[model samples]
Target: MSLAEKLCLTAAFVFFMTGLLTGIWKYRCMARSENAVAPRYVDIAHRSSLMYSFAALLLGWFAGYSAYPDWLNSVAAASALGFFALAIGTYIVHGVLRDTGNQFRKPHRLGRSTLPAWVIHAFMIVLIVAEVGGSLVLGSGALIAIW
Candidate 1:
């Protein structure tokens, strides 16, 4: 596998580990009190981490098998890794803070923290564009190779 593929796989492993750690935290919290509802973000983090890990693995495999150039694969892998890391990190922060309910269901008012919010949105947009664009390039390359 190329270095990019390897790095993607490594990110997958890190995500899996993050999931396991979150799971442990959830279990401990539940064990401590019957009425304790595991933090919404904790559950989200655990589940999403596992899902993202699988996604990274699949993306890596696709990149490896496809006829795309190494640079394309590198971009895809890097984008996926960045998104996964930031997403999980956000979840972890929310979980740690035990913030007000689900941030998704009701948007939290970020009165003074516009910069962080803007940065996150920008990063997410760029990463998603890179990932999707890379995937398209790789898919086209594969199709061209087959014909």
Candidate 2:
């Protein structure tokens, strides 16, 4: 791959590693709690999010780096952010929604998770915007300056 491609790949790989770390921390938090999330369920979410994130990463890299066009970079960067933020965050939100959905079951205090669902949604939105904007600026500039 070209230098630009390599740079994008490095960025994505770094992001993925961060995601992995976040996943591990979240699982650890769950495990310590009385109402711990199951490993199997966590695994499923992890795998799903990882796959989608990887897809976004690769696609964005190729489009931004290989093609090196403004529009292409914009598209790929936005896509990278969207898929990574939404798809991964969705799994987490859905899990909480599912757990809380059961009216009959009154669960324990889930630390800061006691916050309303809207908060999580809003956080995800902010993260997405930041990622997309950041990626576009960084990737686009890199393509221009380096490639």
Top candidate, metric TM-score? 1
Clashing pairs in 2: none
Cand. 2 TM to true fold: 0.42
1-147 in candidate 1: lDDT tens per residue? 787688778988999999999999887777776787687778888898998888778777766776777887787678767777878888887777776455543345233232346655677688688767655665566566677
TM-score for all predictions? Answer: 0.79, 0.42
Quick one: best lDDT, which candidate?
A: 1
Per-residue lDDT tens digits of candidate 2, residues 1-147?
443344456656755765686588568867887878644334445666566557556555545444355554555555455556565655565454444432223332233355556665676687677656556655556566665
Give candidate 1's TM-score: 0.79
- The number of clashing residue pairs in each candidate reads 0, 0
Model 2 ranges with Cα > 4 A deviation: 1-15, 22-41, 97-147
